[model samples]
Target: MSDRNDIDPFYDDRSDPVRVLVVDEAERGERLATGLEAETDRIAADTVPTVDAALEAVDRRPIECLVSTVHGPDGTGDELLAAIRDRYPAIPVVLVVPDEERAREAIDSGASDVVVAESVSERCFVLANRITTAADRYRADRRADRQRRRFREVTDAVPDCLWIVDPEWSELSFVSGYERIWDRTAAELTGTPEDFLNAVHPDDRERVRAAMDRLSDGTSVDLEYRIRRDDDLAWVRTRGEPIVDDGSVVRLVVLTRDVTDRKERERTLSALHSAAREIGSADEPAAVYETLIRTADRVLEFDYVAVDIKRDGYLVQEASTLDLKDGGYYERTSLENDDTFAVRSYKRQETILVDDLREFDVTPADPDYRSALTVPIGEFGTFQTGASEVGAFDRDDREFAELLVGHARVKLAQLQDKRVLRERTEQLERQNDRLDEFVRVVSHDLRNPVNVAKGHLSIAREQYDDDSLEATMEALERIETLIEDLLTLAREGEEIDDLEPVDLATLVPECWRYIDTKDAALEVETDRTIAADRNRLRQLLENLIGNAIEHGGSDVTITVGDLPEENGFYVADDGTGFANGEREKVFDPGYSTGVDGTGLGLDIVRRIADAHGWDVRATESDAGGARFEIVGVE
Candidate 1:
């Protein structure tokens, strides 16, 4: 007999010829071996003289079938059969006997088949058939056993529960992972296959039963249902397929997988999506923080949840769950405090999950909490959840908390931007008011003294006609002009309150007439009408035309044309264009190249353009002159 370990369970021996051992006296055994081998190509026989020699041969090699005479040299064939049966039960034995009585005794002693010695010479084919058939059947049985073991091993390693039952649901033919998944033993479900349904949640039992019925009726079923084990409920997705034989349902094959974690994740995401919408609509930082705290409480189901916002170098608790608020756990920690969980998470800009606060040296905001999960809300602050039980939070809880905090972080940033814009606008308004008051004061206080001086100059001019008196009059006029320009800048350049359609063709000619142009040519090439303050437009046109006349000499040609591609207009003059590096500085207040220029003309033009939400730039025109192009017109 071969050792069990020496056999290759997966090996198939049916394709190879069967090796047979014949045990008898020398001449008889040799004759039997010869006869068996001559009968068929499938049987290879070996002759052994005695029972002891036959046993040795069987042990030495893989012998599929054994053939022995009723009388051997060392022992009776019955003794050999008994020994083989005890040691190598898988091997089939054939006994060669003299008559029917001996054949019956061999059959009773567990011989696979018996052959009569009287017919042995002529019935070699019959003996050959018996030997080959016995060997093939034995190999097939071994293959079937191996397949069963392999199936069990594979099914056991899988996480999903696999089960099979008859169509009538009377017997459970196979079950794997039943105990670990259902929290029950296989024996409980063996006799009563329907007993497994008792572990299903009461609300889902009817649905599970209906699915089973559908499977029995040859209809495949895929369903998700909850199963209860003690006080806990788990979600399981089950898929059942009916095994059909000749168009009739014979058995049901079901694969059930635990989906509790997946279902929980789906629920958490759905809740977070809704929470994000709410948080996004909040116009204030406090409201966003409140929403985050509520979402953490509802989704994570933590014992306590809180939101801390960074204010004045401190993390100030703004919102918290009711339990935390009632317990006076609203803590205020400085940004530099490394001992606090919220501050630590905020400083690190990462999520901190502590399974047991006692294991860490850091101090928790609430000492009663044994576990905590703290997530930073960008640079704004921190969001933390705590529980009284140790190791209450898992990876999923941390991920969900981060998602909620992320939404809050975006909302906080938006609110901060709006607050900054509002403050800046208010500051600009106050500055504009003070500028208006200053302009009025300077216009009033300086104008009275100038009027007195002009009156005194008029008296002096009547008394004596001289160059000094005339120069004094011109200097007084220049100072008055400077004051008037300053007043225009302070009053009209702030913002345009009312805008009416002003024809550039009509306004351009009117502004040209107002400017003291000695001989400059005015060409209004555009008939475009634009929305603007008419007075400011006139002032802008006057400034450009006067500047061109002053710099380009008296006979310079000034062209006002539509910048169709830029959606605005340009004022170009065929004059000496701006010097190198002077284009950018031309619009600055008090920037001038002309000796007697007030330098506020171009600055006023830029301010008016900005008020109308237009962009103005100075560039060299095609006519080799300065060009002021204003774009982004409405």
Candidate 2:
């Protein structure tokens, strides 16, 4: 029989005719090599009668892969493996051994892989690729030692933890720096990284374990989560890069790092940014203050937050989004000699962040509140209607209470100003409505009488054949017509709907029929539909088209067309377009820049559109007249 530790006894492949160097005892090795060549045209075999020739070819020549015996007549294969490793360290050396013990020795001697001939084909390809790749890596590694060192240093410089594992989630090796990973001492996690995770708070263990499994399956993972510490919980990250052997995952390593501070800052900044937007958009002072309370809680809700709206000189806590809701904020306050932090803050209109309110100025005689932050709402310089308070607290919360309060100051001022302005606007709008209604009714009633009188005078002048009387009647008729147009414009706001979806297709044509088109041309163009209140939309289009007619020259054209160009829609007219400076003012009740017209027509158009959440703007149209565009809607 061939030397027991020669190359594979069975022929594995017959393609691309492999040239294999078989190292074994002289006589039996030649027999097997000869048999292998005769068995298949796919294999071309060569025999090296001693370990010496095997070592020489492996060291000096370019061989695709190697097949050598671990237990030769001389000894075990370590000497041969060592020789190959010294010269071509990257070349993977596959040892043919009869037993696992020999295989182990072969591997330790720097064979890239090991296999037994009894099942050699089951693993020949595997061993062959390993030897080839290991040899190549060995050569490159020797050449690029400096680059490898720099690469290692750079990888270490990255703040995140890195790791490697197998598809089975078994750890191969964590980096050397894994010891100092968390709040735990290195002694606490000396053996395995899993043990460190085992010490994690029970709540986070399952999730962390799951994340580890996902990482093992060749996934790029980015996650934010809490990691338990000895005393408290801290946020951490577990990240990894997969190492694939033979195009399949052989091992994976992962890194973990603490990110508590950065995550907390992000949360705070996000809350502040959100609060800023909410404050800017809030129409009601209460709604804006509500956003403030929510933001304070978002930062440190566990600490306690109280929102007070001062009424009748009493600090009435209107709402609280606290960690412990319904609890008395009194116990959380620092009141020294009857002056509480909340009171002082409200009185001075200043922001105070208290780490321990009860301990501040506390001598048993002056036990003030502890761990409280007071943000005052004194903007509008005259909420004089009352004072307000929104406070936050937490144990490990970031020291962002004042920053939050800083965010609050500008927004509160804006909200309060908005509130006051809204109230005054309501008052002014009411007075103007009253004045417009008064104008409408008086004008409507006076207009008809004037027209009737003008008609009778015209008839009398015609019957009496008096040219002077005819001129007087004609002047009166003209006056009557002007008054009637004013009355119609005033009454535009009279009938708005109770809010329902109005089909623009149905509404535009109806308005065109009702409006006074006696002096101007009107056209309705519809392509798509709009959801709006029925009568209100009709009125909006009515006033707009009527004004186009009233202000436009003799060939006046009112084109009610959908604005495909505008994000929403509009009505453009070929008349004298509204003047640039007075466009915005055109919506105000008494401000009209049109010739011989009451300005309320376009104002009615704007108010009705605003109530429906549509924006109306005036621009010059290609139609050689004014264009009112409603933009930014779906």
Candidate 3:
């Protein structure tokens, strides 16, 4: 015998060698030894003279293939083959039998191959090749089984669906974990590659098909589309990667995920932003409702929207998505009518969300509309939307509706307030016009009679008591002064609409020329040009200058200058200033410190400043006299 270390030159060490068990009597074993040893390059042989030895040899170490004689010392070869099949079913068996009858029996007994005794001498190489090939095939199958088990474990743990298709797309090559996601078995979806495309929504079918057409190269595929299985619909993101081998496309593997929640949220946010921008810029309440209708129809997918304003214990329709021909039908129908749902929401001061409009007592404007959402705008009204599909209004829709309604309520209130202010301003202007006319008439009608009385008393002074005539003339002079002050007050009360750039330096001197300064000196300090109503500003300056001259001595210096930081202008006099606790009351009409003074002058100054949107303040001047500062000049 050769040493165990001697390797045959014909053996391919890279291939797995078969370990074979030869079970027979000693004579037969020795007879077959020569043929088995000839192929020792690929087969390792162990001789056993009996079935018991064969069983012991198999248990001691794994046997890849078995070669047995028809009859062994302890049992028949078929018996030994049966024993190994029961215990190590994966091991292949080859029978070396004496005759054709036993060969048939061995063939029926599940042997891997059968060799007749006569043909064994000439077919030794072929027999050994079969044994080696069987062993290689078994090992490959075992490795594939292990890999499949590991793949199943990994795919079962994730939420994604994994599948593979051949490059030709004739059929699916591999599919895993799809049963859990789509509630379908692998066998059900494996034959047709079009099964995947068929499951996609009709709108996305062409996109998916186009993506598949681009899968010829070893490129990746990513797509988002909608899918439907029976009545269930969802947004799915599918990504595919090609399996390449030697720069050739082998197959495409794909993963699909459900992204419905993410897509819905994104759409809702976009709708809300669009609605807010459109509604906020609308100028009137009607325009706001119109914008809401268009935005909700385009983005929120609402088929109808209505705006109702509460008036006289009834909700009146102000705006709607519906276009009425006569327009009186909508306006004539109030929320108190039996078929309106807005009244319910308004009465409860809460939102009403109905999946099916049939549940409500009232009939919807459109019979196709099933989903309804109504939000109350405090006591003002209700804004409602209706959709054609049942359960279309989800929690996201409800939240968006509430936000839009809240913003619309604020804009409507602002519009109403603006309208009220405009009407009130017009009414006050009419009243002022009437008052101005009355003052002009009184000044014209009463001033001439008093002047005539003064003249008549003067003429009578020579013919009557001098004391009585002097008293009569003094009364007439007081009446003339009162009439002039009243006329000035009434005229100044009118609005100042047109303003021009008036230089204070030029205006103050002009006003000084009109005032009786007596002996007061005028000091001009400012040259700033301010935007003002020229005539109204002249009146303001005249009043301040006259007030200063009346209180200050004839030699008192009246200073006119700009305030610091362009706040406005200041008029101050170098005279004995106001006493304590008199500044706040200085502008009151008919409140005068001098017995001969008319107190309407300072009040008219305040009115003119207010008309120009300026603020006036009374304070002490630098020369210990009164100061009037007009701030907020433009």
For each candidate, how many residue pairs have backbone atoms clashing (under 3 Å)?
Answer: 0, 31, 1
lDDT of 3 by residue, 1-634 (tens): 1112122323333365567777777767655655776866777777788777887888877677778767434545778789988877767888877778888988887887777765566667766777777777765555565567667767878888988888877778667778765667777664655877777889999999888777746778899999886698888888989889999998898898878878877886777777777778878777788776666666676677778888887777777777666331245345655456677888789999989988867777567778888899876888888878889888877887888788778887888888999999999889878886788677877887888888888889878877877877877888888888888888787778899999999988899888888889999999989999998899889888888888887788999998868579899998999988899899998888987888888999998998888999999998789999999998
RMSD of each: 4.9, 17.0, 9.9
Cα lDDT tens digits for candidate 2, 384-434: 111122233443343455555555557767666777899999998998888
In candidate 1, where is summed lDDT lowest over 10 consecutive residues? 1-10
Evaluated with TM-score, which candidate comes out highest? 1
User: Any runs in candidate 2 off by more than 4 Å, and if so which?
Assistant: 1-174, 186-225, 245-250, 269-283, 308-350, 354-368, 378-634
In model 3, the Cα lDDT at residue 308 comes to 81
TM-scores for every predicted model:
0.81, 0.37, 0.61
Tell me model 2's lDDT, rounded to 2 decimals. 0.61
lDDT of 1 by residue, 1-634 (tens): 4434236666766678888998777888888899999989999898887777878888898888999878434546888899999888889998878789989999999999988867567678888998998988987876787778888888999998999988888788888998778988887764554586888888989988988888899999999999987789999999999999999998889899999989998999999999999998998887888788878888888788888888899988888885544663656888875468788888889999999999988766568889989999888888888888999998888888888888888888889899999999999989988897888777998888999999999999999989999999999998998998899888656778899999999999888877888988988899999999888888888888888888888999999999899899999999989898999899999998988789998998988888888998999988899998989876
Candidate 3 Cα misplacement greater than 4 A, ranges: 1-160, 176-183, 200-211, 216-227, 232-248, 255-374, 382-394, 439-480, 490-510, 519-535, 552-557, 574-576, 622-624, 632-634
